[model samples]
Target: MLKQFCEHCGEETEHKEVIKQKPSKYGKSKKEQFKAFLSGFFGGVASQVGASLDLIDRYVVCKKCGRKKLENLGDEFQ
Candidate 1:
């Protein structure tokens, strides 16, 4: 369990890992879908590059406050 300060509760609390799903396209046109697909592909590539370069910072949310905060875990070398 991860212990972090919660702004809402005003105290430190243990947090559970929350895995959120990427929202799906509900009512998009064909053209919009194509554009979104291209954008997602390029965005994924860019994120891969950033991850390999250790330029991405990951974070966890506070259990009580639901505040997303990055812990100082030093550099992540892939």
Candidate 2:
């Protein structure tokens, strides 16, 4: 399961899981697959947060529409 703030509406949204019709037989087990998905999702989040922090450290701000306003902190780190 994946969740994120919608860039257009700034609302929290759940990304539905996509189930394959034919999962690979040689692939990871169910637990491993779950873990991998979670790890990948969080990895993406971590990278985004890190990039945002890097921007703030340089006293810079993104001009991205709704994301900037939602992510901005007032002289503090999230």
Candidate 3:
């Protein structure tokens, strides 16, 4: 899903489910599933760490429409 922060409501939310390609035959296994889960977990942790370090930008959007809006609670961010 597309994760976006709602500046108007001061909340974090997601819009639609992100379509990710499923693993191929070579990668479709129990071990592979665990690896993928671990990878995602670590990636999310790293991202959070980076955000805490101010190494990334914070994006705000509309909660109901998933539009990028953070300026005046009605205007889109870009």
Whole-model Cα lDDT of every candidate shown, in order: 0.57, 0.42, 0.47
Q: For residues 1-78, write the lDDT of model 1, one tens digit per residue.
A: 988677777888877654332334523778876765665566666654443223334467876667877543345532
Q: Which run of 10 residues does model 1 get worst, by summed lDDT?
A: 18-27
Which regions of candidate 3 fall more than 4 Å away from where they truly are? Answer: 1-26, 47-78
Candidate order by TM-score, decreasing, is 1, 3, 2
RMSDs, each prediction? Answer: 7.2, 13.3, 10.7
- Superposition TM-score, candidate 2 onto the true structure: 0.24
Model 2 misplacement above 4 A? 1-27, 46-78
lDDT assessment of candidate 3: 0.47
What's the best-to-worst order under lDDT?
1, 3, 2
Most TM-score-accurate candidate: 1
TM-score versus the correct structure, for each prediction: 0.38, 0.24, 0.29
Q: Put down candidate 2 lDDT per residue, 1-78, tens digits, no spaces.
A: 445555555566554332221232325788867765555456556644553233222212223332332333434545
